[model samples]
Target: MISGPASVRERRLWMRTIAIVNQKGGCGKTTTAINLSAFLASETRRVLLIDMDPQGHATLGLLRDPSQLEKTVYEVLTHEQGVTALAEIIVRVRENLDLAPADVLLSALPEKLRETPGKENKLSEVLEEIRKDYDYVIVDCPPSVGLLTFNALKACTEAIIPVEPSFFSLQGIARQMETLDLLATTAGHNIKARALITLYTGRSDFAKAVAEEIRKHLGDRSFNTVIRFSLKLPEAVGHGLPIAEFSPRSSGCADYRALAREVLADEPPKFAPSRVEEDPEEAIAPAPAAALEQAESPLEPRMQVSPPIPVIGEGLFTVETPRAREEANSLPPAAVLEQAESFLESRMPAAPPMPINGEGLFTSEAPGAREETIPPALAAVFEQAESPLERRIQASPPMPVNGGVRFTIEAPGARSVQLAADFNDWVADEMQSRDGIWTKVVPLPPGRYHYRYVVDGGWQTDPLNVHLEPTPWGGYNSVFVLEGNNGNKVH
Candidate 1:
């Protein structure tokens, strides 16, 4: 059981809930749901896989016998007296992973709840009670459009339609997308839907052509990672174990891990407000007196201030802007700024004095000191410094020594931190902490790489590193380039 302080769990408004839906069977829908949930759990996230399909394939995939269970999602959704709590049916299947098994009885849920009010929201209401307990919930929908699928769609904020590389699969996806759009409009909930190519055979020309056609039609709406055909996948499923544990080095495991990384790189989809019926009289009501008075007044002209222009001196001193100069002059004579500057000057390396010209403040000779000394108080102000030299100094990029680079970040209150990068195949490696500063060292050859820090199950870019590139998922990845015995931060 993954438990945390109430305060910590409450940091997220709701866990990311995704429903795997496809009206067409044998399209790898159940396979994607099971494997994706497993890989996400392996990434140190608490995940729950709910088998909405009465066939109980997801439960069996995790090696559980749904028939022998005392309770399952069927009881929770269709109980006569009241709905059963979701927590009671949850069974721990693996580390950081749980399952809500289903059996043949779940197939009767549609008829049982046909006359019930708000029947389509039964699953949604049940999940709302424990939404903060897990990081993700994966709902495996049955291979048909019915009440179960409606409940899954109503409860989820995102949907993934897994399609095999074939013309039939492609044709099925169009209908699936249409259904998703109709649900989103009628339910007034925005759902982010993506297409994933599964069961792909890279060597086959037909498969390659179909994959290309899917990509061209979906554009950025399709996943880049394709689930290639692998014999080991079914073997793992038969054993009721994830590919990560059964065959860690198999292509099936590699592809799923890559898919999990892509999922983590993106932020959770935001939930849209549901449609509410309002009276026509209230919809066009006249504005209140106070609102009307405020709107009638002329809008104030906003003041626009230009950015400060930097002027570098012989000792790398920067001149303050006119507004800054006035603010500094207003301070007390014994202000801390003067004392800090004096302390920094005393600690700086010795440099040759330059003759200052009267009018243009020209320097007769360059300073011998190669680096500028920054005052403690001024460091914060220089955070947005425009000059390359100033920015580099402020960033304090990690240096590579003896073919190893030391990665460090200060996260004062984080429970744990891990490093994930392309060099490690995107598997998060636990980082050690000392005095709230997390550190890790990885050996690498001369090459460029992108990375991110996983702080307490949340993906974050290194705060100290200024170099970053935008990810396709609407987030940034910190960039690092190792050259010889030195490391350079790059964008």
Candidate 2:
């Protein structure tokens, strides 16, 4: 593939999505959807809530107007459309929450349902194209479990239902379960639904009894945290602020926070995505640094990088990582191989003959048996090219000779990095190498100089240097000492 700008890769990594929905109307679904999304976004998790409902409540809750959207999810999700092409349509409503705005045109869904084959998975198809852009995608569903609701359920990995602690809410569980089971088996999306009790009350006997009844029905399926009935919830919705920002100190906000944490804590289920054929890249084992760290680290997927070079010959060069390819780019593979062979050939000097002896036991020696003469020219080159990577690696600095200073020593990655010393006013840095080596000779005056390596445009500690101290975030920092307090150079 052709190279793209780096920002394109950066926009892909922000994700961990959950679509909040309930089939029944008047179940606090929209309130839970927007507030939980807003609270999660407030926690610094990048979120995008797709409002699949025709009522456009989630859209109106987040945006100034829902029907006014010129390029809504309806158009943006078309086969001719994609996220990058429609990113301009996705408006930034709050800090990290972006809404793919929708309007009431969806109210006609029942009439047009199944006009196309497998219409339920349309949203899923579009979402898969841009799954990397969000940490959490909180989708708000329409009340009737219509075509739009089916599409959202098919697209989302998990679902959260805000039940109003009423008998009818529990009664609807059977129908909702049937929908989830059908989508999981037919559409190949095993969507998990986390049931949450909304409009909870502590003092009222009827509220307590209703909450207990719902829990008995749900058992471990319902979330442990109950959203207490509070006036702030409705007020926040009317003002278009998430309870977290509107009335953060209220119980409603706290309940959503706890529920959001639980939802975030659940593991993303492993399901086989619908595909006819898979690529070698998808089948290959993921990089341990990235895939294994997914649950722990916040790294997004890379935008563009070439595939690893297939190992050939004796495998002298191991795996082709981002570092190896970069260094290899400086010297083409053909040139590198040519140079290595030449260096090896230089070592195979012509065989020499042994010395002649006297009288009866005299033996004649051929030139092959004679002693070989060492040439100064060949000897110097031999020493300099001892290592294959040495063409890029710098040699050790000068010793404690006059004006030689052991100001500092450190190196990080192998090609094209920099280092700055406190002795140099932390000015321009000397370049570092890609073969994991660096050496610099500096004429310094007196005092100890603190130094650090600036690698790949970022300030970092040297992997080779030992004098390290803790910096911010418990990261290591390199410390340099100007021994003898005189102008000198040391490796």
Give the winner by lDDT. 1
In angstroms, give how far residue 104 of model 1 lies from its true place: 1.1
Worst 10-residue stretch by lDDT in candidate 1? 351-360
lDDT against the true structure, per candidate, is: 0.65, 0.54
The 10-residue segment with the lowest total lDDT in model 2: 351-360
Q: Model 1 Cα displacement at 400 (Å)?
A: 52
Candidate 1 colliding pairs = none
Measured with C-alpha atoms, the lDDT of residue 363 in candidate 1 is 18
- TM-score for each candidate, following the candidate numbering: 0.53, 0.50
The deviation in Å at residue 191 for candidate 2 is 1.9
